[model samples]
Target chain A: MKQYQRSSILVIGGAEDKVHGKEILQSFWHCAGGTSAIIGIIPSASREPTIIGERYFNIFRDMGAKDIRVLDVRDRIHGEDKGYQEYVEECTGIFMTGGDQLRLCGLLADTPLMERIRQRVKLGEVTLAGTSAGAAVMGHHMIAGGSSGESPNRALVDMAMGLGIIPEVIVDQHFHNRNRMARLLSAISSHPERLGIGIDEDTCAVFHHHNEFIEVLGRGTVTIVDAQAMSYTNQGDVSAEAPLALHNLRLHILGHGDRYNIKNHQPIAAVVE
Target chain B: MKQYQRSSILVIGGAEDKVHGKEILQSFWHCAGGTSAIIGIIPSASREPTIIGERYFNIFRDMGAKDIRVLDVRDRIHGEDKGYQEYVEECTGIFMTGGDQLRLCGLLADTPLMERIRQRVKLGEVTLAGTSAGAAVMGHHMIAGGSSGESPNRALVDMAMGLGIIPEVIVDQHFHNRNRMARLLSAISSHPERLGIGIDEDTCAVFHHHNEFIEVLGRGTVTIVDAQAMSYTNQGDVSAEAPLALHNLRLHILGHGDRYNIKNHQPIAAVVE
Candidate 1:
């Protein structure tokens, strides 16, 4: 038996070398439930989804994923792939490759692929792993980058729907290097009740169903923006030609090796729920 | 007459103390070219736009806006005041009072009010300014939040439309305190050729004509992320869920009292074309 009753799921932001790939693979392979393989991705939005395609295959191969397939269905309008059934059936674990999250969400929204992934995670028999864009789209809400810090104007800034694997949490990748913290803070400030998670380049944070949190191999820290207790008004519904005002907003930051049990949606002690 | 032509606009972000009743009043009296008035915002998506409403009216009135009027257009659908025409025609400058950006965007997206304002700025007959949410929307692209930096999976997090005043520039207000440098960098990385400008709190960078730039009063520095001459692929368009690899991205930082000119889309010394 594994520590989590449900299938193991590993969510990662991009920069694989920093994401502790080797450590995660070892742990998933050791799961006694016998894992299979399923790969989810926003394939069409990326210019090189095939870049690490072979590495993922190799990892899953070592994890006993005899059959591995990458779904490149950019849209339902394009239809599904051929071996999706076998991949889903034998899927002891599902992996999501990181790329362009917008591209991923574009494909998964109201599509059969997203529906299937939701069902698998619900069944808790499969493991889920995603990196970079893959990890971003897994959550209910995700960060869409906006204008430069030079201008405070918030136009053309929109949010795309996601797989909803994790609700009330918005995620971003390439954090510090990209300096996306302000964008994330503005994001959570728009919705004070939500929590924003930012995994640094090449880092991974795993949340288990049994209430355990583990920091995979990576050099960067995870930045969490929790506006649960704060109050803000983004004027999101206001006209774009006007100024927006916000008041009384607060945030909390979390790091790797930290545990935030989702059951209650608050920062908790570093212990299994 | 104004120095810069249309097709490009400068957007200002917000801060609380910057709106000291006496100072804003002076700005209008000394710097403003025409009659000024204050606009009040009502409830929309977030907090009340009232705080800023009072602040603007008080400041404008104190600054010799004897013809000043508070167009309390809180609810666009239901509460747009009727006395806008006189003010619009008579005023030399337009100040977008602070409120929830969503509400402002909603009320002004297709209304005659936005049309007039756009026309005024296009003709260089009036200056447009905003704070906070008002500032976020003045870009060719807006962040619309939803960007979770935790992972690159959700890169296309979410986006909303803007006034389309400023081209190729995405603005962020209240920068350093919130750490949005990364988000801006991520945004710039998406379009390596584009420029990302992050304005610190209480700071304003005014873009005059097509080539002139000036920094305004503020405590923090302005950040710019320029990604030209960089190599990145498999981003926003990947074949699968692979970690998008970005190579050779460069960043620039600008602070107060610093000015630069954009000649042929490149930042250089302010000069006459």
Candidate 2:
């Protein structure tokens, strides 16, 4: 086991407040060393990688980061390129933008660039922030695509492999706003051992102390699904498209300033100042 | 443990040759006591349950059945009706037609009519034959719906509760014709403990001796997927829609006249007579 000196992972739901009170991004900015942060923006998930990459680069730059680099690796070759790999290794903070998670994984999966980022993040040397599709890729088991506004069932969600940045939990973005509770529930039905975290739009679940805890931030609430205590689920017994019944799954809804212990699956109320 | 004296289950893939030969249906008819058979047709899965039920009624009538009743229960109330429950109880064999499995389960699941059928089938007092969606619902864990031609992944299949006529196995119909290999593989990834039996069009996997053995019949073949020896699976690790990798899953393909030991997961070739 590696000893971590300092590590922080900021997971933001999609459609964060970019103009008024950019609290989530600002929190990410401060955690990335603020004025002295050497930031790298990865927008490979977007169809317009350059535009998306530049967008994040400008946001971090405007926050007074000493250096900002848009490392847009569009293909496997680009992902394997030494220049991109070096930037991923050297960046103090890395931000991944949202678009298509399949495309992102297709281009970067198993690449040296992702391996380096994973290594640095694991070593507590870099602060990583991802939003929307970016946030979806943080789990070892990723939800590549799924529909909302449906009952929880196997057909409601699609899952794939992820970057394993946070292997213990599966993350969903634009959660409650998009009626993704069913979708996330469908995902967790297959993986009861991992925690399911749904970050509402503009919300952030900031991980610290080696991902042992999460501090909810921003205006929206974070929904936590803990199935470790789940007694029964018809997931293995049922066919697709059928409504599922899951028993004993614990759910927690937390607002800004609320903290949660990931290891213990417990919630901590923030002390009023 | 309840000792099974004589129990036979015919799981037919869809599009069985009702016109020519009709080897699979003939086997089912013979197992149902041939000329002395008192059969009940449950077409609750079909949109036109009455029509589908009568169609099977006519087929059995043509086969010189002593008696045949089309027990077309379309709703839960109908499933609970004493008339339907009596028909289910008196029938020597039950034949379920293919349509929408979800609809079938919605109407009949947990109903007294279905409970009586389950009880009789488990007691080796009745022979049961279900085709297509009916076949899909034989397992304790059912495959309600799914898409074909996709790589094996969680998204490729949807699963729901089934009749559990055969609790130890998951069955898929129209196997080769519809290219349901990946679909069955996807279903089995979530349920490695249950045997996967994919019956090709016009084929049947006849389970006998308390479902411990299966004898293949009809023009097509039976593909058996046994994941008991599986060493690893990325099913829990990947998100939906992403391709999955399952290692050491043993697959067996058997043609007409071949036999298999379900408990041992071993195939026995046909003897030259």
Q: Which prediction has the highest TM-score against the true structure?
A: 2
Instruction: State the lDDT of candidate 1 residue by residue for A1-273, as single tens digits.
Output: 135334556667676562245554555444424353344333444657565565666666666744566665655664355466445655656666766777777766666656766677767766676777777876677665564333233342356666778766787776655656555655564555666777776666666763244333354555555445333333464454222323322222233344455555444322223
TM-score of each: 0.49, 0.51
List DockQ, one per candidate, in order: 0.04, 0.02
- Cα lDDT tens digits, model 2, B170-202, are 898877556566678789989999998888777
Q: Worst ten-residue run, lDDT, model 2 chain A?
A: A1-10
lDDT for B36 (candidate 2): 80
Best by lDDT: 2
Candidate 1: what lDDT? 0.53
